[model samples]
Target: MSSEIRQLEPKQLWNKFADLNAVPRPSKKEERVIKFMKDFGVGLGLETIEDEVGNVIIKKPATLGMEDRKTIVMQSHLDMVHQKNNDTVFDFDTQGIDMYVDGDWVRANGTTLGADNGLGVATIMAILECTDIVHPAIEALFTIDEETGMTGAMGLKGGLLNGEILLNLDTEEDDEIGVGCAGGIDVTAIRSYDQEETPESKIGYKIVVKGLQGGHSGMQIHEGLGNANKIMNRLLFDGFENFGLRISEIDGGSLRNAVPRESNAIVAIDAIQEEAFILEINDLANDIKTEYKTMEPDMVIEVSETETPDQIMDLGVQEGLTRAIYAALNGVYRMSADIPNLVETSNNIARVIVKDGHVKIGCLTRSSVETSKWDLANMLRATFELTGCEVEFGGDYPGWKPNMDSDILKVMVPLYKNLNNGETPHVAACHAGLECGILGTNYPEMDMISFGPNIKGAHSPDERAQISSAQKYWTYVLEILKNIPKK
Candidate 1:
């Protein structure tokens, strides 16, 4: 965290953001942040409750002359996706984010900025602290583990809050008002295999793929960005088929929600094919870079000599695994029929690991349509199952269906236009997984809408927040709070 960011306009929100970012809040490991929020609420002398599942709820009575307005629920998840560049040396669990000002944006040094929901969390904190900001009764709900599985939202029990309207401040685009979002499920395939001794004449080499602009798997799926796992498998498949390559180890990608940016593998090939192998692999690597020249200018692939391993995977299993990976899907599966240019279904083959005689392939599949989601999940299951792996599905959550006539949508559309010099906001649905959908499972009657500042390259080290947009978004938040409909 930097003092420079705390000096940004709207110090109320930026200051809170700096304070919050100073504490480590990685997804599924939010114990420190949970306690921080509870302490903040307790310090303010507000009624705060920590739910059984680790969600924090702070209640504030209506401001003067606004008691008749409906109590509004302001929600933002507490945890953030943890991602860093391969060479960055920092512990996410132990240290605060190292952020700096980069012209119009605030970015971290080779690590994710946690702007996806941290900014939203800061907005509520500012409101809860400000005395002059007008508003109705407030229910500030901070859920944890949104990036991994939305476990906090899923575990929320019904009848916890009495608010009639919900405002989710997790949308990434400042000019867009989110009315719905895609649902998601986690798909993992696992198996163990036999290891065999390497041949006497085999030579070892390390293949590295990195420098790709990885991003949010769901929101950026249609952008055609390079997936390192997919690219690595392509190169491996080529080596095995043409040069008699044998795989000893592979490790790629990190979180299931982030597009894989790098992959590294150890492989062995017959000694006689050394010259031809180097030439072909370099040529193939160049071909991949050229193919993604426009979308991934920074993409890089490297191959180097390394010590040969004593053992490698059995030939039969290696063949099956490579083929299975090639057959699996990595990007968009279907486009929305109702909304123009909206992605209806997609998959991100996020993690691939082959080590210690065990193989694990992790994926996150998302879709707005229920049937289409399963259609893609089963398709992936079949592909891995064919390779003698057992597949499991978990973290199932439903999509937030668009409510074109939502009361909050009607209120914010014109408010946004007025704030932006008559520029009407883009009212639409998104492909990202938002907690609004999971929260709806327990609160179906609450009308909801999501909007936030301009945050780009989320779930990756390139993640940053635009300074100007945060100011604009903060103004809109104040207006919406003051204009809540009467109960």
Candidate 2:
């Protein structure tokens, strides 16, 4: 056993986490992690089961003197969003996450730490394996493919979960209990174009945007971070007018739910204007960066030489892509008038790709209200249609509606306040999607509330969880577990 894998508090739980991290468990590729979890439960003599969709459930009998307590379900997703820096070469399917301790916090080197839900998993595993902590009959529910789609949660049938109370351990802010979350839908646009060889008189230049703090679109949308794709498109449109260049290829952003931190484009320009064009772009980059420096101080725009200057997009194709991109919706569409701090609707132009004569654009639209979601989708679809491109809306999950008088909230808020020295924890709705939304529809009677430690930069490389907050969260969670009411 590696020293890094040595057990921490709740050895069985952290051991399972360390062991699970050793295996690759990116979304849709969580078989090894799933199997390992089930086997771990079996070795501990607990009842374990796997659903057809790869979700896992482990049931542990009530601890001594707790059989009379109501059964509580602890839930978190097993799959993680696989992301890494451009300089890193680790593979998600083959490489274990390189984790290390920084003072009091634990994080992965150059990648997502997976502490998002892994902590929840470890906590649940600890409770089940201890045969010690006095608590209710517990069910540890692990769902799969939650990052890309809530397939596991969506497919859950009635009676799968026997627990009447659920504690969701996926919120980022430690002191804020997530009572609701925005529903979301994926929107994609595609346009087919004929290719044409570039005229020999043209020059090629690579336009690059770098050094922005891209974060989870839902969590950080209101943070004022720059979207690389949007900024790049703005520059490209400006360049085309001045230099009469044809875009050969443009690509940016990694995930549909993350803010784009960097982007690059290949353009063919008139050989005579190449030098002047590069200079102009460099200047524009700095100007744009200055404009957004309060939020994106690290932003850099560079126009550099490329190996070949011969490749070029067809004139009409270039126009279609540029127009569609310029017109596509990006940034917060609406702010909540009711909730002072809430963002009611927003869209992130999350990904852009050019391949096989097709340039595809991907965006994720979010809204707490169903009408707002559809309204944003309609705006995107209309923008694409205006550019003569085809657009499609992916299947969307419903939002978790906030119930102020919810039974779960009634129980958790008091526990939270008492644990924090009479500090009343904030009650807020998340713009991000949570399993509660899907689980509500699947199991009508289930009541859910999400709470967790203070985790920053979720879904991005800068992600980190606060040490003090974790201890507080654990303390509060334990209290909630012991006091949940029975029917």
Candidate 3:
């Protein structure tokens, strides 16, 4: 363990998080982490099972006389979003995360800290390793590919878990308890284009927009953060309409669940119009900076000369793609009428790629209301279809409806108040997707609630987890387990 994390209180939890940091476990590529987890469980002499879909379940019988208590399942995903600064040279597949203590929080050096779920996983590991804490029969369920897709949760068979209560350790806020979460689906649009030779009289330039604080698309959609793909398209569309620019290639964003932080494009323009086009781009960049100055203080736009390309996108295809992307919905569409400050429906234009003879655009839509979810999907489909592109939707997951009368909530609420001297914890639903929803489909009878230590800037390089909250959260979990109602 690193000296920095070794000094934090709750050494058990931080030590486990440090160990996880030394292993590369990006979403959809968790083979190493899976083996590490299995080894950790077996080393503790616990019964461990790895399902066909890569989900790991470690069962620890109740301590002493607590066997009659209802079985409680503690759940967290085993993967982290792989993101880094454009200049950072780390590879998620080969390099472990570099973690450090920043004042009251733990963060990475120019990369994601993976604390969104790492802290939760560490907490579970700590509980399993400690024999001194009193608890009911316990099952630690770790799912895979949660950031990119809920494949493990979706493929988990019914009756795989014998638990009657599920405690999801994936929520971000320390003081809030998540009882429900939005369902989500991904939309992809693809269009084929012909290549046209670049005119000899045209000059090539690379235009870039970067430094935006990209975060979890669903969690930070309402924060007014600039979307790099949208911002880049706006500039491209303006250049296409006013300066007669032709695009050779464009790429932005990497993951569908993360807001795009940076985008760059190679475009050509008639040499005669180059000076005026540069001026116009500068003007637009300044206006955008002024508009988002508060939210994106470090946002940068750069236009630099580049070597000419052999071919460019067909004029018609370039125009159509620019128009479609500019018109696509990319932010919160509605807010919940019942839950104050909860997003009801939203969409994120997550990524764009211009490849060989084609361009693909990806989006993610989330909503707590099932009908509203599909309504947004149709809206995106119609928007893209109007631009003569083929659109498809899949990877849909159901929402976990909130149960105010839930047995776990009934026990946790009062217990939390007593633990904190009558400070009532906030109960709410998250806009982001949680594995609890998919797990609920397989085990409809399980009562579920989610809570975690404070984490900020999830899915981004700036991600960090609060130090003090981890200790309090660990204590809370232990107390909750001790108070579980007997069967």
Candidate 4:
């Protein structure tokens, strides 16, 4: 099936994508990909260095007369978020992504296509391995663990790269030139609870919240797609209120970055209210579906009877857990006053698990403004603390502040216009977390910009990349490389 992906036009880029995806490069688990990259750089006989924290840097001298141009950094993370559908059986650790050609797009079979950064990685790899492309000195940077925490970027030391400008090929929309991006922090809440013996009168059932269109929590946070954890909590809250339902175990969502798509809970309820519970839940599910019909047309909320559990969460803890999740924020918090149609601050209640006398809740908060980032974080911390959960904040990274006066922007804007029937590209900041910000700390003077092909449903199983857009973007990359400013 991956052979189909290799056949896409611009074989240089698609072939590299297929090769990269053939290796398992999940975040925080990139040993194989790291080796692959090192071998690639060495194979080309270029100056290659694998930093202490696992970032690979491959440098190539300027080709032909382009030596007069400024050196540039081409960066994309080597890692991809590992996500799959509930009904799909795939091992992200051992097997390569099974991809197929779908109309004008390329997609994985029931799994994330890894186009977010893989496409970017492929683009750079194509150029690095090329013999005819006219470009300035290239510094190919491949970072690890970008999907989960960005630890690779944080751990990178200074004085390593000689480039004066950076061209980040990680932006999703081909028509947009990204000048800025949001920073993020991880919010985790944990606590202990006592499980009580299930009442003799209680019977068990399974509640599944699926079919929601989950996506990149940051890029699509403003789209109003449903969050599975929030939807599941709503169902549990209503059931407990009406039927004195007791929770035995609940597991919702997967990664903290991808908006949750599926959630399932095991619960026990008083048998006397079984008939009423089914009717009430079905009606509520229908109401929820109606509320999101346009955004999540395929959303399905179902409850089915299941084997009984031996224990249920303490009534007090159960009540607190539901209330805290209900109170927590899960979508866009503020729009940028500085930029039109930009999400300035937001939160994704990304994951939730309540089981075995323990509770864990994970969230990712993003904001371009430093103060606003913590403001929303404290909001989540306070909300969960109300439920006696000790919350911790980690993986803090800074946002990329937009430079309207950027020299690279000036070069890219007019070039993009000439490339597209004189149509101007959208010059703006995005809500998604890009490594441009983190990479800037050590090289403050480096002018940076990001752009890429159109990738939809990123961070979710429905992820796909456009074939035509990739060709268009490929042309842009070639032109940009030829036009790097003189040193």
Q: Per model, how many backbone clashes are there?
A: 0, 0, 0, 0
Return the candidate ranking by lDDT, descending: 1, 4, 3, 2
lDDT of 3 by residue, 30-93 (tens): 9999999999999999999999999999999999989899999999999999999999989999
Worst 10 contiguous positions by lDDT, candidate 1: 1-10
Model 1, 356-391: lDDT tens digits are 899999999999999999999999999999999999
* Candidate 4: tens digits of C-alpha lDDT, residues 1-487: 8778788889999999999999998898899999999999999999999999999999999999998999999999999998998899999999899999989999999999999899999999999999999999999999999999998888888899889999998999999999999999999999999999998899999999999889999999999999999999999999999988889989999998999999999999989999999999999999999999999999999899999999999999999999999999999999999899999999999999988999999999999998999999999999999889999999999999999999889999999999999999999999999998998998899999999999999999999999999999999999999998999
User: Which lDDT values do the candidates have, in the order given?
Assistant: 0.95, 0.82, 0.92, 0.94
Q: Lowest summed-lDDT stretch of 10 residues in model 4?
A: 1-10
TM-score between candidate 1 and the true structure: 0.99
- In model 3, the Cα lDDT at residue 15 comes to 89
TM-scores for all predictions: 0.99, 0.96, 0.99, 0.99
Q: Considering only N, C-alpha and C atoms within 3 Å, which residue pairs clash in candidate 1?
A: none
